[model samples]
Target: MRIALGLSYSGSSYEGWQSQLSGNTVQDQLEKALGKFANLPIRTLCAGRTDAGVHALMQVVHFDTDLQRELPSWVRGTNAFLPRDIAVQWAREVPAQFHCRGSAISRRYAYVLLESPVRPSAETGRVGWVYRPLDGAAMREAATHLIGEHDFSSFRAAQCQAKTPVKTISRIDLSQRAGTGSSYWRFEFEANAFLHHMIRNIMGCLVAIGQGQQQPGWLAEVRDARRRDAAAPTFSPDGLYFLGPVYEDLYGLPTRTAAYDWLP
Candidate 1:
């Protein structure tokens, strides 16, 4: 039987989402825990791979099991065996043909910015700290140009191993959250797919525009340029969150104009 499992993990200790040769990985830990439960070799295919230090609020993964274990027990059992940082939130029987990664119609990633002179206590895992005053309005304007299908080579990481650089950024919603001292900003983006480090790279360019280092109109020209050098530096991964994967069948998922938030 095939099962779809909802997982959430803190990527602090792991090398990345994939298994590694020399370091701890989220996949390695998951496989070991699942193998223990199955008493047989087990593996999972995740909806997405987050880099080290990244966090996923809701990541879907699927695995096949010949042992017809109860679906609810898989969630309870997996959580019991897994570390606190890695958890199995929910599990259900899925069609054998339902693939967690390939079947995903869209992916959403949110990058947070804590624009403040002083560090914020409430935003350790949630927001990236920036000491400089960021122009929130400018950032919003700059991000508008990125909301379309384009060859995103200008913002892709040089180390990115994807076969192609083209991606359709369906939406890029930039806004500020209400706060007292530190201004909290969010960049919520939805795309059919994303290349490695794509969201952070776009955040970097947006930051540059906010800081007046780059002009707002440069984003469109950079897309047209299709050169990696055309974009600014990559933003820190600490402020980014893989909010959730958008399956076509889930109606609760936010649409283009919906206010984005962390999802389970």
Candidate 2:
């Protein structure tokens, strides 16, 4: 039988999601807990892989098992052995054909930023920081140039393993709000798929435009360059969050997390 589970984690203390020789990844911690709970080895494939210091509101995974445990037990039991920063949110039985990654139609991500005269403190590792105020209008204008299908090589990482540089971004929403003495910025991105560090790289450009360091039209020039050197450096992963992937209704998985309402 195939089992699917929804998970969430704070990636600050780890080296990204994929299992590595360091044995300090979220996947390693999760598999250990799942194995211990079932008293058998378990392996899981994730919907998407996140980077170091990145976070996930909901990450989906699937594994094959014959333990016959109830769905609630899979959730509560596996979580019992997971670290405080990692957790299993929900679990369900699915058709053997279901896949956590290949079945997804698109993915969503968000970057929460803190813009203030003084640097962010308590929010240091949780949100990206910018000392200058960001211009939402300018950033929106720049984002428009990236709305449809195009080569995003300028924003991809040097080590990106994606087969193609072309990607389709369905939406880019930027919002701002005033806090006690600081301003918060939320940048949301939805795409058919993302290359390594794509969001962070684009964040760097949008932020530059927001701070008036570059004009909104500059985004088009960068997009047309098809070279990584043409764009700003990759932005911080501190504020990035994997909002999870969208799957067909046949999967019957929950789309949103409780944290959704609290976000911008």
Candidate 3:
């Protein structure tokens, strides 16, 4: 039988989503816990892979197993062996044709940023920090240039293994809320797929425009350059969160968890 699970984790303590020889990644921890629960080794494929220090409000994965068990057992049992920062939120038996990654229509992500003269303390690892006040309108204008299908090589990482540099960005929404003595900015993105470090690289550019270092139209120049060095440096991964993938309704999989309500 094929089983799918919705997962959420604080990725600060993990190496990333993929399993590694160090066995310190979220995938390694999850598979280890799953192996313990099933009394046999279990392998999983994820909808998307998050880098270290990032977080996931909803991450989807699927695995095959011959052992028959109730859905709740899979959730409660697997989580029993998982660490406190990581969890199995929900589970469902899926069709053999359902692939966690390939079946995804689009993926969503959010980057939480804190703007303040003082560095973050309580929310240190949960938000990106900028000491200078940002020009929201400038960033919004800069973001508009990225709103369609285009070559995103300028924002992609050098080590990215994506077959193509072109990706369709369906949406980019920016919102802000006042915090104690500071303001919190949230940038949400939905795309068919993302290249490695794509969002972080974009964040760096947006921040440059917001800080008056570049005009909004500069973004188009960077995009046209199609060179990674033409864009701003990659921003911190601390603020990045994988909001999960958009799947067809036929799959009957949950796209979110309670953790979504907690994000800024």
Q: Pick by lDDT: which candidate is best?
A: 3
In what order do the candidates fall by TM-score, top score first? 3, 2, 1
Report the C-alpha lDDT of model 2 over 1-264, residue by residue, as the tens digit.
999999999999999999999999999999999989999999999999999999999999999988899899999999999999998988989999999999999999999999988877877888999998888999999999999999999999999999999999999998888887789999999999999999999999999999999999999999999999999998999999999999999889999887667765
TM-score of each: 0.91, 0.98, 0.99
Sorted by lDDT (best first), the order is: 3, 2, 1
- The alpha-carbon root-mean-square deviation between model 3 and the true structure, to one decimal in Å, is 0.7
Q: Which pairs clash in model 3?
A: none
Better of 1 and 2 by lDDT: 2
Please write out the lDDT profile of model 1 over residues 1-264, one tens digit for every residue.
888887877776677789888638888888888888888988899988999888777778888888888878898887887888888777878777788888888898887788888885755765777777788788778888878888999888878888889888899887787567767887888999898889888888888888888889988888789888888777788777776677776422223221233421
Most TM-score-accurate candidate: 3
* TM-score (C-alpha) between model 1 and the true structure: 0.91
Alpha-carbon RMSD to native, per candidate: 3.3, 0.9, 0.7
The TM-score of predicted model 3 comes to 0.99
Assess candidate 2 and give its lDDT: 0.94
| Winner of 1 and 3 under TM-score | 3
Give the Å error, residue 234, model 2: 0.9
Q: What is the lDDT of residue 76 in candidate 2?
A: 98
Lowest lDDT block of 10, candidate 1: 251-260
> For candidate 3, what is the total of clashing residue pairs?
0
lDDT tens per residue, model 3, 197-251: 9999999999999999999999999999999999999999999999999999999
